[model samples]
Target: MNTRLLAVAALSALLLGGCTDTSPGGQAVRARHEHFEELGKAMKEIDGQLKADTPTSATVRVAADKIAELAPRVKTWFPAGSGPQDGKRTDAKAEVWTRNADFGTAATRLEAAAVALKAAVEGGDAAMVRAAVKNVGAACKNCHDAFKTD
Candidate 1:
């Protein structure tokens, strides 16, 4: 009876573990999706502030800082086997994996732009902030155009 109980318990553990989609591809898909969503929210908040006639510098700085923090982690979010072909609903194109070096460069550009935006915001100059925001947007567009799908 004791041996049977132990065998049943071990089998149950294995089955439960297998049921969870903890595979690298599954984890990467979920993480990258979440990261992009966060980035989108931050960008939207910053854009809203920028569009205001009398934008709040503090709010803009906060949103820009969030983007700066997330930028570097963007590279890590797209691990191997996380593309659309992995039977996932990701918008990431297969070219992201094939042209990984270019993807890394694009991520670096976004990081640099995000850092610049944060610094511009700190300077309390509206014109500088606007220019930095445009740079950041361009960096994002460059990557999305190459590696992402609509």
Candidate 2:
């Protein structure tokens, strides 16, 4: 009788643990957060190169290419039901879903800015690179203001 009760308790614990496991939305949140961290790292790499006494064009090019590659996928990161509604810890605000059109426009703006940055790098103009970086920062800020939580 004691052995049977212990087995039943162990089974119940496993079932309860499964119920509390990360939901699909939680997984999405984690994945998107990771991608965004990569994006931030790439942007920071570019910024570091720019701040150097002699900016390495190669470093800037690699970082710019990464941003361009990641920007367009920003929209897919914030799918419906992936926000705080999932009971997951996320910086994404409810406005991301409620004001989705504006979010989309912001995402597009970031993508365009990234593309412009890539083009500027290809042009081999330091001034153009600076300007493009500014545009990318502006696009990120715009989206954060409207769609992200503090």
Candidate 3:
């Protein structure tokens, strides 16, 4: 029974090991996507708290910093050999990948805006925070408008 169990375990390991693609590039994209989605959700929560007139600077800063950190990873989704644009994402647009340069520029803008937001959060000034949030939101929206389906 022990030998049988050991054989089964070995087979399971072999079968399941490469079954999951934990490739560096693939892993990076998945991680970035997860981080960005989390950033968005966190930001929405922070925005909701802010709208409630609650002191959520710490929360907002956390979300903002997450976004800032994840922003530069946006390009990871577009791998060199990733092929001709996957529009099936529903959230993705054909043009974003088809017009690669434009997409990269937009991604860079997002990273830059996120960096600014990070600075604002670090500044810990309410007015500056608001302005930075606005700027970061604008940058995201601008890219989404052109690249995202909805």
Candidate 4:
């Protein structure tokens, strides 16, 4: 009876593990997607604060700092094999690899925009914050347009 139970547990573990993505690049794709989602959340938080009648400086600062922290790491998210060609579930376009230079430029632009955003937040000028947010959004859009499927 104990032998049978052990066999069943082993089979169950194998089945469950098979149900998940065990591809070579799957983990990298998932991790990059998660990072992008976090960046999106920070962007939304900034937007929410902007929409508020009296925008919260602390909230903006926190969100802007998050962008600053994440932007520099954006390039590392897409390793060579972590794309659609590797059969990983990702929305990153083929151009990311094919046009690597352009993608790098876009990533650098986002990093610069994020740094500007952090500076703007520190400056505590509403107009500068708004402009920095606009620049950051534009940088994101540029990359998404060139390198993302959706």
lDDT tens digits, residue span 27-64, model 4: 77878878999999999999999988334479889988
Models sorted by TM-score, best on top: 4, 2, 1, 3
Better of 2 and 4 by lDDT: 4
The TM-score leader among the candidates is 4
For candidate 3, write residues 80-130 as lDDT tens digits.
Answer: 423224212224566766887998999899888888877877877767777
- Which 10 consecutive positions of candidate 3 have the poorest summed lDDT? 81-90
lDDT tens per residue, model 1, 1-150: 699999998777666642454789877787777788888898888889888843446778788889999999999998777676775556889988888999999999999999999888888888888899999999999999999988
> What CA root-mean-square deviation does each model show from the true structure?
6.5, 5.3, 7.3, 5.5
Show the colliding residue pairs in model 1. Answer: none
Best by lDDT: 4
* Model 2 residue 141 lDDT score: 91
Ordering by lDDT? 4, 2, 1, 3
In candidate 3, which residue pairs get closer than 3 Å at backbone N, Cα or C atoms, i.e. clash? Answer: none
Q: In candidate 2, where is summed lDDT lowest over 10 consecutive residues?
A: 13-22
**In model 1, which runs have C-alpha deviations exceeding 4 angstroms?**
1-21
Predicted structure 3: clash tally: 0
**TM-scores for candidates 1 onward, in order:** 0.82, 0.83, 0.68, 0.84
